[model samples]
Target chain A: MSALLEVEGLVKHYHVRGGGGLFGAPVVLKAVDGVSFAIPAGRTLGLVGESGCGKSTTARLVLGTLARDDGQVMFDGEPVGSVRDARWRSQRRAMQMVYQDPLSALDRRLTVGKQVMEPALVHGLGAAAERHEKALSIMDAVGLSSRFFDRYPHELSGGQRQRVVLARALILSPKLLVCDEPISALDVSIQAQVINLLVDLQEKFSLTYLFISHDLKVVRQVAHEVAVMYLGRVVERGDPEALFHAPAHPYTQALVGAIPTPRTRGRARAALQGDPPSPINTPPGCSFHPRCPRAEARCRSEAPLLRPLDDGRFAACHFPVLSTPAREAA
Target chain B: MTVPLIELKDLTVDFPVGGNWVRALHGVSLTIRRGEALGLVGESGSGKSVTWLAATKLLPAKARIDGEVLLDGKPIQGLTRDQMAGVRGKRVALIFQDPTSSLNPVHRVGTQIAESVRLHRGFDAAAARAEAKRLLDRVHIPSAARRLDDYPHELSGGTNQRVMIAMALAGEPDLLVADEPTTALDVTIQAQILDLLAEMRRETGMALVLISHDLGIVADITDRVAVMYAGRIVEEAPVDALFDDPRHPYTQGLLAALPDVAGPRRRLTAIPGQVPNPAALPPGCAFAPRCPAAISGCVTAIPSLDAVAADRRTACFRAGHATPWEIAA
Candidate 1:
């Protein structure tokens, strides 16, 4: 199947005052640098990374909410140059974004029904009565009962508020959904509820998702393909099932190993040393070298470009974890 | 052979809300041995945090704490204010989730640590400063002396957390209560903090009460775990048994709901509803509505914690097959 959304060479840099030696020249923080990915129709591309790793920036760039410094975006074979184009307005009807905090994202003044129906009304897709019907249907699809239609944002539970958010996004009948840390604010059981809902909604709506989250477990469960980002760059990309088992990049290995799972009970996990360095002062060669355990003089001087390996996966690491089972077990 | 480091016997806490006593904890009993790590797992309003806050007398003035709090087998509930205060700060230190808020933004982190050291250790300024640097170094903060002069804002979340741990250590507390300590941090940063906590516990031999909602995280470090619902302990077991063969339906439900990163992909079986409002909890079991194995008796009668398998206790009628509390019609 043809890819529904395609992004190539996406870059977004923010200029901030200070950090320039002697002169007060601005420091350009590369929020997203040279990122590329494609999501096939009815598929999900999970972007997993910690804070300041540019996953959210990449998501916004993919959705065209934030202007990209340099990139190309193609939706259904049509190039999207700028959001200013009149055609982009109509194109936005096929795309939507679900933010992390459902409560803050919503207006307390508006009722759930009106909030869900606002997208349909804004697009001028139907009359007031038709919009009402669509909102009810969408709310029902997201597991929100009609009783919540007139309820304020505060009256609803965290999971219920998120369902309302999903209902609002789905009301637009968007083909592509960019969900950024959508369930991170929720509790465990409630997070599972939202995860199951997302899965069911995908199967029912045949939706394409660019799921951006730091939750590796949820990402592995919901995403067909996973991309591990480090300091504004994609370090590894591959299928979740195999990739998680035998992570190719040392960074990916650290990430996978660092995850607190009951399966690896007796094994000693050498956690990644420190937090990701500030994006503004990203390291000279590989940005992850400062925290990587296997860093060498070569890693300090030359950055390894993300390239394919014999294992049918890609990693931006010179000394990668061998994918072969024999080598990995030893 | 001696008494546990701390113990809570039939503890209950109630706050006067609208002239009526609204219960926060319903008869919680737990023991923390010296150098042992205990995990308290529950959602918000589950009384896991309250159990510690009440034990430490950190709850608000109006919170009515009933039952016995033991320190070295002596009932501390009857202790005088000055005695309890000394026992609280010098022996049992508390760390919160947001260290930034707990820390003074204006003061240098070094000064904060030194202050804690001086207060707990009764050290002079120069000695306190030296001890502060040593504590920082013990927490694995690189260049501890240099980072001491930096303000809380100057440090990363991970680094700020290390400082918090250092300050908590300055007390040389016998038992440290950490409430959702790593929840606010990023995953990789959280891993670093968790590693530091584990290493520090090994070095200090201090009892650690880790209050968190993350089951995987709790399972990773704690030797034993207590699962709480509404305002009571639903189950208590060794960490391995709790994860492997959870008996309580609520515990089983929680495990089934988790998404496994390294395992096969399966549809998550989420519990049907949200946690009940503590103010208007249903009669009998607070978790009956959410429990998959709830029975008719579970609707009206509360279940008391009963011993189940060896080293395990569950407050469920189904798990232990023990009779629940008798009630009037």
Candidate 2:
């Protein structure tokens, strides 16, 4: 299958005045620097990272909510432009975003049905009757009943509110969905419900997803392929099973080992020490070296580029946990 | 067994909301033995935190609390505000999910820890400061002495949590209640915090009450586990037993809902529907509305917690014959 979305060398930086008096030279904070990836049609690519690791920024950049400093984002074989551009406005009908908090994403004053119908109305897809019909059908698809149609967002439960958000995102019949921590704010049971809903919806709609989350377990369940990001860089990318079972990057290994598994009781696993360095003044060489357990002297001064392995995985590491020759053979 | 360190019997807490009462806790009974770690697992609004708050007399004045709270077989329910204050930090230390907000951001971390040490240990400034440094060192904060001078904001979330641990330890309390302590941290940082807590518990022999929504976390840290739903604990058992043979339908559904990292991927059997509002809870079992194994009779009468096996309790009409458990078997 061909790639539905292709991102190349995406870079986004913020400028803040500091280091001197009132009007000092601005320091550039590279929120997302030289990030690149692609998502095939009707597949999910999970982005796993810590809070300050630019996952959300990448989502915004893809959705055209935030302009990129450099790089290209091509969707459906067409170049995506600024949000205000006429072509981009029309192109946005095929893309939609779902955030971590549904309450914040939804408007309090409007009923869920109205909010869901608003997208269809804004895009001028159909008549009023047709829009209402489309909204209710989409709501039913997401498991929201008719009783909740007129209820405001506050009246709904967290899981129900999330369903309303999903209904709104699907009302326009978008082909690509950018979900940023879509289930993080929910209870474990409710999170599972939403995740299952997403999976069901993906199958029914044949949707492509850029799933960004910090929960590796949930990501593993949903994503066919996974990318591990650290300080505005994709350190590792591969199939979820292989990447999780035998992670090549030290950072990925630490992340996979850190998850508290119920089956492994009192198992001793290496935990990464220290906090991720500030993106404002990221480390000289590898950003993960400060917290990496197997940091060599060479890792301190030289940045490793993401290199491809024989197993169709990519990792940016000088000394991978797995031997290079064996991994290549596999 | 030698008068458990802390025991709560038939504890009920209610709060007034717009002239109506919200039943936050419904006759919660639990025991924490000395040097034992008990995990309380539940969703939000499940009264897991309220149970601890009411046990420690930390609830607001508007809350009407009824039931017995005993500390070493001594009644502590009717204690005066000052008396409760005396029991709070010196005997039982409580750490919240967000350490940054719990700490005084403006004050130096060392001074904050020293203040607690002085209040509980009756030490002078110099002695308290010395003891505070020792506590920080115990939590494994790097450059302990220098870090003592840093403010809460200067330190990372993991470091701030470490400082919170140090402050909690300054009182040298016999029992420590950590409520979602690592929820706000990163995965790797969460592991470090969990390991540190385990190490500290081993060294001091302090009884621990770990409250979290993550089953994996609770399973890893606690010796026993309690599953709460809608202000009531539906199941209680040894950690291994609970994970291996959960009798309650709610517990079984929860365990099955969790996606295993090392297992085959399949559709999660998520429990349907949301938790009922406390004010408008159904007459019978709170989980009946969402329980897959719920029978018709489950809607009319509340199921009291019954002993299902040795050291295991379950509150479900179909405890042994639940469909989910049968599938697991």
Candidate 3:
């Protein structure tokens, strides 16, 4: 199957001020150092990580919101050099993004109907009457009431506002959606509802997703394949089923372990020490070596490339967790 | 042998909305023994925060709080503003979700900790400063004496959280209410913060009321667990019993809704619909709209918390049994 979206050798760096010597030097924070992945047509790739891990940066790069320093972003076998490309404008309709904070994403002054129909108008889909009808249909599809059309962003609840955002994204009928922690801002009770709506819509529309989120549990629910990123790099990538069952990278293992389980109580977890190292002046070789529990001499000097294991899972690690009968028995 | 360190009986907190009272909490009762950790697990708008705030008499004037909230067998409901202020940190300390926001940006970390000690314990400048340094050390903030002068923004997220914990511990309160304390920190840091709370709980024997949405964290640290849906406690039991065999349909749905890391790749079953608005709750059961095991009787009859098993209580029409999703085919 042909890949819907392909990103390779992606790099993004932010110019951060201060913190060098007596006089602060301009430090370049390497947000997305060298990340690469692909999302197949009609499938979801879950990018899982902690806060400040460059998952957001990578998403911005894919969405063309943030420019990459050097890389290739191929969409439907065509290279996307810049958003300025007239062809890219047409392709924009095939791609849409759902932000984390729906309130911030929406224009509070505009009504819910206007917000949903604006995308359609921007794309020059149809006439005013047709656009209004299309917006209402999309709202109904996402489980929003028609009564919400005339209401402003502030008038609706968190869940209702998020549904409006989904309606907007779906108005374009995009083949791929870049959902950056879309449900994180919601309450738990509402989170499930929004997730279910997304699932139902995905099946209905045959959509592909680049779902970026900090919550591993939610990511597990929505994603078919999983990619674990650490310090602006894809540390591990594999099938969600295999990755969760037998995480390869130590970071992935720690992340998987850190998740609160319902079955057990106070199981001794091997917690990592200290915050992640500064991305501006990262250590030589493995960026995670400083906090990695199994860090050895080789890990310090030699950066391990993401290598595919025997089971087709890829992990960048000097010492991946040994998968034995005992480990799998859990 | 003695009364629980902190007890809340028949507590109800109501907020004035558009001229009428919106009941946030309804006749909730709970107790926490000294040194024991009680986990209050619920989704958003479940009144977990409001329950603690009202119990501590920390609610604003607009919020109407009724029922008994006692600390060391003394009623705290009708205390004067000054008396309530005196009781707040000295008897019951609160640690909020975002540590950075809680800390004063302009003031140094040491000054904040020292101020709490000075105000509550009436310590002098030097004594309070020394006590602040010691409190920081207790919470595992390295180089406690030096970091005292550091501003809140100067410290890392984890270090700032330590400052929050240090401030909460300075008064040496008998009961600590940590509301989503680890939600802001990274997962590894979250684990560490939880460990720090456990360590402090062991040492001080201070009763803890941990309010969080994360079931895994609650299950890890707490002894007893209370599951809240809308504004009512649907189920309350020992942590193991609740996780092993959840009685309430909402509780069962919540557990099943969680994407199990160890389970097979299956569709996660979510409880339908969002949490009903606090101002406009359903007449009978607040959770009836979302309950998968909801019956016709559930719509009109509000289920009181009844004992379904040994030492377990559930507020559901079908108690003492599993929901359809939980039952094995």
As for lDDT, the candidate ahead, 2 or 3, is: 2
The digit string of per-residue lDDT tens for model 1 on B53-87 reads: 89988899999999998888888877788888788
Residue-level lDDT of model 2, residues A1-330, one tens digit each, is 679999999999998765555688878888998899999999999999998999999999988888899999999999887768888888789999999999999999999889999989999999999998998899999999888889999999999999999999999999999999999999988888899899999999999999999999999989989999999999999999888888999999888888886766556868888888888888988889998878889989999999997789999999877753212111
- Pick the TM-score winner: 2
- Candidate with top DockQ is 3
Per-residue lDDT over A153-255 for candidate 1, one digit per residue giving the tens place of the 0 to 100 score: 9999999999999999999899999999999999888998999999999999999999999989999879999999998999999999767888888888878
What's the TM-score of every candidate structure?
A: 0.96, 0.97, 0.95
What do the candidate models score in CA lDDT, each in turn?
Answer: 0.88, 0.90, 0.86
Q: Output the better candidate (2/3) by TM-score.
A: 2
Global CA lDDT of candidate 2, please? 0.90
DockQ of each: 0.53, 0.57, 0.59
True contacts kept of each: 0.61, 0.65, 0.57
Candidate 1 interface RMS: 2.9
Native contact fraction of candidate 3? 0.57
* Runs with alpha carbons beyond 4 Å of true place in candidate 1: A19-24, A324-330, B320-329
